[model samples]
Target: MASNYLLALYHKTLRLPFGRQIFSRMFASKAPYFKTIKPLITELRPGYCELKFKKRKAVANHIGTVHAIALCNGLEMAMGAVAEASIPKHLRWIPKGMQVEYTAKADSDIRITAEIPAEAWNIGDIAVAVNGYKADGTQVITGFITIYVSAKPKR
Candidate 1:
């Protein structure tokens, strides 16, 4: 298992004040869509990633609740972070599809967590489980993001 560059950068940048903001901004630069939700990576390690975000006007729906697409974006961001840390350097991955369920209304800040199973390391489609929870520990959404894993092409 090689060092995960994303995790390494997270550790290095987290030592300074406002580092999480800096990290999020840097990440948004690469994936501009993530900027809409203002996701902050709170934790990242092998097989796991956690991201937190607030329900702002930008992410609100017609009824003023957190929009479904916003939650999906947050889920994808967490899943991507975990996948990047979980896969070996020799392998490559891409999101295949996502199945999600909206269990409850999201009216406040929320946290999203994604985890990869140990069995998912074998070459194939891996289903990563992602869940969104509110401040009171209530689950708002549950999702499974399938990612295609394969060997990296030789340069």
Candidate 2:
């Protein structure tokens, strides 16, 4: 499954339009964030993805800490990258569900990491778990993302 998806990504890169190719390369340089927040993808691969998000005053709720939704944003960013890198181009995946556990206050930068199952993963429903922590190495949030993967129908 890992090899298959990597091959597909390589193939898809070749098929992308000239404009998209350039755009993708640029986007790959910087990870997109939620609204005003910009998360950076520090690491990404077929079976793993990691992103860093800094806490900002705007993202802070009345409690003066990172908003709960902002933590979820980091989780989604990590999981989305894992799905994008792990699933073949012929298939698509969506977040079916998520369970978050916030353990600490995120006052600084938060790093989120998601790992895909190793070995050959069969086509079907899958769940990816993402973990986020503050700069001090305290756990901040966790999420489980359910993804459905299936072959796209013929045109």
Candidate 3:
């Protein structure tokens, strides 16, 4: 199918240096949200990332709509990307806790964008927030993740 070809091209383009920007653009184009539920780093910049996903029946709850946890996964996806790209490579980051809230119904794919300012970042106990929105631009979920950043012992 044409969609398959496009996805393949997108994947290949993401391997380049400017791939981050390109990937971000492509993700925005498709608005793929469910496909990224497993927490994938499709695009990563200094302080931000674009997460993608696709809605599936399995992700539905008793209401037969996208589950709240599924939306939370997208939020965490954005937070994880920001955490990995923001932390110093010499240090390790571990999630400490998260506060989540569900505000609306999500019937379509969604994207979660997360970012943090450089001056606000700390090597010890970094707290970040990621907000998820539906394709129609409705806020579906919000989460605040606290991570503990520490130095690893030199081998």
Candidate 4:
């Protein structure tokens, strides 16, 4: 199978100074909504993606905590990265649904993560695990996003 472009780019660029930043910016541009959170992709591999974002007024709710929607956005960003990096070359994926739980208040910078087992990428619904952690490792959000994977449509 062919190597995934996103994964290959990540490996190639992460070594250069500021290359990770460039890659993150380009990645978020593909899904513009993710830019709203000022995401930083800290890790990207075949079956996992991790990112971080700082909390600020724009992302804070009325109580001065990071809003749930902001957490969801971060989770989605990580999930999209993982899906694109992990899927087989012959397959494609689209998000079908997301189910998440707000477990704790997001009081600091958040680390979001998405991971999938290699065998899970098949022609069916795949529930990818996602979570957001506070600076001190407290899990502020937990969830799974379902993605529909199938063979790429013929040209």
Candidate 3 per-residue lDDT over residues 9-54, each given as its tens digit: 5457766887755655454344456344533445556577667666
- Candidate 3: pairs in clash: 32-52, 32-53, 33-52, 33-53, 33-54, 34-53, 34-54, 35-53, 35-54
Ranking by lDDT: 4, 1, 2, 3
Ranking by TM-score: 4, 1, 2, 3
Model 1 C-alpha lDDT versus the unseen true structure: 0.89
Error of 1 at 75 (Å): 0.3
What's model 3's lDDT at 39?
37
Candidates in order, TM-scores: namely 0.95, 0.75, 0.71, 0.96
The candidate, 2 or 4, that scores higher on lDDT is 4
Task: Output the better candidate (1/4) by TM-score.
Answer: 4
* RMSD per model, one decimal: 1.5, 5.7, 8.2, 1.5
lDDT for position 30 in model 1: 75
- Give me the runs in candidate 4 sitting further than 4 Å from their true place: none
Clashes of 1: 0
Give the per-residue lDDT digits (tens) of candidate 1, residues 3-87.
8788787878888899988887787667789889999988888899899999889999999889999999999999988988778
Q: Point out where model 2 deviates above 4 Å.
A: 1-35
Clashing residue pairs in candidate 4 (N, C-alpha, C atoms within 3 angstroms): none
Q: Which 10-residue span in candidate 3 carries the lowest summed lDDT?
A: 1-10
Best candidate, TM-score: 4
Best lDDT among the predictions, by candidate number: 4
